[model samples]
Target chain A: MGAAKVSADHPGIDELFALLAYGEVAAFYRLTEEARMAPDLNGRINMALMAAAEMGHFELVSDALEQRGMHVQQAMAKYRSVLESYHAQTIPSTWEEALVKTYIGDALAADFYLEIAEGLPDEIADVVRGVLAETGHSQFVVEEIRAAVAASDQQRSRLALWARRLLGEAITQAQYVMAERDELVDLVLSGTNGLGQLTEFFEKVQRTHADRMAELGLA
Target chain B: MGAAKVSADHPGIDELFALLAYGEVAAFYRLTEEARMAPDLNGRINMALMAAAEMGHFELVSDALEQRGMHVQQAMAKYRSVLESYHAQTIPSTWEEALVKTYIGDALAADFYLEIAEGLPDEIADVVRGVLAETGHSQFVVEEIRAAVAASDQQRSRLALWARRLLGEAITQAQYVMAERDELVDLVLSGTNGLGQLTEFFEKVQRTHADRMAELGLA
Candidate 1:
């Protein structure tokens, strides 16, 4: 779980890559599913673009895993059931809800990964950085949510709840991952300044989530 | 309807571009829907890649429409109902069915568009050619179908029926589009050698479809 254990078959790094790689694939499909519920072609196309972006990111991480001699499917197997259940439980009921889920869910996931990336090797960190950087869909989501909320107080309140629910589900899934992948958890905790950084890490994610909510007029 | 009437407001070209652009968007959504039923991560990733390819092609055609001073949404509106009906009537019920539908349906549509492209202006023809050139997904479909058929006769028979149904529904939708868009029909007839070539065109498409089916072991 330290520099002494670092190798091509390092359990911590392998689990991290598997988690991130599978997460990207899951997001790709979920985004496509959400895109189907978009109210118009513009929204639909935007969602599709985001989905394609996720797929591109998935290919990057999966390629990284393959280069390490891990089969992508076998590497991804552990996370599949949990991720599927999380998505099933949190299925968006409307176009607006789907948009909110995608925006909030993706931002939170990105922040979590970015924090974890700080402790990873340069190669892995570089892939995470590249994916996090390609978040051009945020502006579109902000514009959409703001416009919908501006249309009515009822819409605003409904979406605020939706955002909260998205955050809750994401946190629950993150917790599940942490519980299941001890190696990955150890990697993140050790990679940070110390064990104390876990509290600081979560606080940072919360701050960003609140800032994002305020930006969308959901504060 | 003739060469003398071709201008900035040419109904034939406008309708053609509109249909083509909207068709790509529809296919993007349909491909995503089909991808969800994929049997494995590899298959899912492949379907997603195909969906993303359709989206890329959509942007190309939509950009062409914009260059001609037509708004994409407005251009696509005319074909919405007809294309929606086509998809609604031919929803695939399984992975094999989806694959067969995607392969046969896309090939038939490509043949139709290629025939019409011959009768279109250079700008529109170029867009059609680019879109048709992105048929890399066909080989994946062929391999998957052949593997399934080789595994069992029951699965092969089922997929063969699915392919025939997909073809039948596609032809029905094409007829519907022809009946609905008189301008597009006129454009094809006037731009091609004449009405006599329409029969020759369908024969060519049918020939290609038969060859594709044989290649997939569905003959």
Candidate 2:
């Protein structure tokens, strides 16, 4: 497509990309800080590794924005409030909570990014695919969650409740974004049958969560 | 040299390496945890990056141990008490203390590692060089320290006092290790006239700290 057509088609792509970039940067910052909450040296190192990987994503998205003639700092500033509020409202309180946040939050982020990637141009899609392929952080989260669930019945119930709470908070914060950013909401809701696509998206996420919970013997 | 001859010549290399490996792991844990003391996201992320870089050192040392048919976990266990005690006693209470600990401690670590690397085998030296090459964390600490020192005269004096306290605690910890682990101390204190080399090492570190203080206009 021509430049004009591409710009018209993906009106809010820059904003969305910028928002995701800031999200990655914030994740890197928060995860690294939270890694200290680990009780053991090994756990701490592994969490740090996961946090560092988020920097790789941040650099990739930032570079993409630069390539598109957008200043990264300015773009990031636009969505800092939304991103910061999300983190502020969803701080993990325990190892289990942290793992649940990493697992559920990362999976949802990957799904959303993947959906957007499919709609973007080839170069942007390529960058997203590259990031999506590096699932080390999510894998660590999954293993930890499964291990925690398998260790004890009481722990499983507690963590399952925590996971549900994290999901709830995430949805609440996401709604804030949707309400405030009309262009972003419109872009996401476009090319779908009203709220049906969104409902299906939520259902798919719930199904995935159920599958994970069953795998961990929590469901 | 033959394996037996090499072991005999570098009798305490294993112990020293093991202690250093455990130190890196512990530092990674402590620094990652200490990142939370940061007053803002930027400071937290900077500390996190430093912690993450230490994990790279941990992996390198762990792999070096494994290559020698040694289990990293077993080696790490040998120095656990010493490493734990050092961190437990020196936990920073404020941002200034954290910055001093990161800046001065990391620089001292780099100097000590560089000194020790000179006497190690080629394979071990290469690992040390690789780990030392990433100085982003050190740069971040320097920038932060400089900014803090410039903020106010009182801030500079307070941070200088904190740095001295950290150094005193570190020396006490080092002496404890030296008294407890003669072999490791011997490895470090070897190749020079007994206490002279040890004294010179301390003096070198002191000079480096002075230089850093001068750079920050705090001296």
Candidate 3:
């Protein structure tokens, strides 16, 4: 299949960039707040470190938007409602829940960003790729989850269930976003196998999630 | 006066490293937490980005300590009392206060770390220098403080007083650490001209602080 051409006025590109920036900003706030829920100083510091990484990604995207003569705040405001609703509907209630959120949520974002990065112009793609490269939070989540599961069977079971719920909420919110932003949906569906590629993308991600769970003795 | 040579077995080095690591961790925590207090999403995201940079520094130090067969947690525990006391005594109570803390606190740290980085062996020094190179947070602090001061004369006075208090507490804590850790004091004094030079070093820093205050219209 031929690569789909995106115009400069492509609403999908605009919506995607705006949503990505807003997501970064919200991740910064939410992760910093979540860091307080850590059981110990070490855990707290680790969460704080992860939260900070989100900010670096935010700067990259915001700078890109500025380069286009777009006001970041205005662009961010455009997608605030959908993003806020997603987060509000999927609040993590415990340490395990938080870890799952960080782990799965970041993986989904990384996958999508990587795919989108491929279709953008060089400068924009570089920014997106650089932002995606800073995935220390995911590494932390995997380690933390493994350690928690190793500590007890009960903890393992609880976290496994929590991870599933997190996945559900994430998918629900994501579908809402895709439905609302046709341009974004088009951009995502552009270079892929076809319009149905999203389903395949979801399957691949779920397989990765399952592998991670099995590694943690959750499966 | 001749520089005092520090003994290889000097417990003060341990104490100093402990104090330094603890301070880094706390700064990482506070900065990340305070990012939430940003009035606007942009400001909040910037603070969070700054907080994230500190985590990179935190990891560098933590890894360095680990490589030396030292447990980061134990080292942090050793200096918890002094570092926690310092922060508690000088907690910022407002946005202006927070900016002052970031400005004065980060600047002093950069200066001291830069000096120490120069004196250490290549591996250790390289990490410290690498961290010092990332001054986005410091720049943010300077900008925020300058904007706040430019906004109002009263705001400048309040921030000036807050900055002074922060320095006062910092010096008090430094003196306490100096008295308790002769090896570090000796290392610092020896690396430079002498005890006399150490006094001059701090004096130079104080003068710079005052200059910064005046430049901000706070003096």
* Model 3, runs deviating above 4 Å: A1-9, A114-129, A134-140, A189-208, B1-17, B66-69, B112-129, B192-201
What order do candidates take by lDDT, descending? 1, 3, 2
Q: Write the per-residue lDDT of candidate 1 for residues B146-174, one digit (tens) a residue.
A: 99999999998888888888778888888
TM-scores across all candidates?
0.90, 0.82, 0.84
CAPRI accuracy category, model 2:
acceptable
Q: Give every collision pair in model 1.
A: none
Report clash pairs, candidate 2: none
Quote the lDDT for A136 in model 3. 56
Give the Cα error of residue B195 in candidate 2, in Å.
Answer: 4.1
Q: How far out, in Å, is residue B130 in model 2?
A: 2.1
Minimum summed lDDT over a 10-residue window in model 1 chain A is located at A1-10
Please give me the DockQ of candidate 2 compared with the native complex: 0.33
- Off-target runs (Cα >4 Å) in candidate 2 are A1-11, A29-39, A66-74, A77-94, A135-148, A151-158, A190-196, B1-11, B37-39, B88-94, B191-195
Chain A TM-scores, all candidates?
A: 0.91, 0.87, 0.88
Residue by residue across B1-219, what tens digits does model 3's lDDT show?
Answer: 233444434444455455667777787677765655678766776666666777777777777677667788877786777777878887777876876787778777667666644455555556667655565656667777788788888888788888888778877887787777677677677556666777877787788778877765688
For model 3, residues A1-219, the per-residue Cα lDDT tens digits are: 235644555566667778888988777667767766788877777777777677777788888788777898888887888777767876888887787777767776776677666666566667778766665556667787888889988988988887777667767777788888778788777745466766877786677777767865678
Error at B180, model 3, angstroms: 3.0
Candidate 2 share of real interface contacts: 0.29
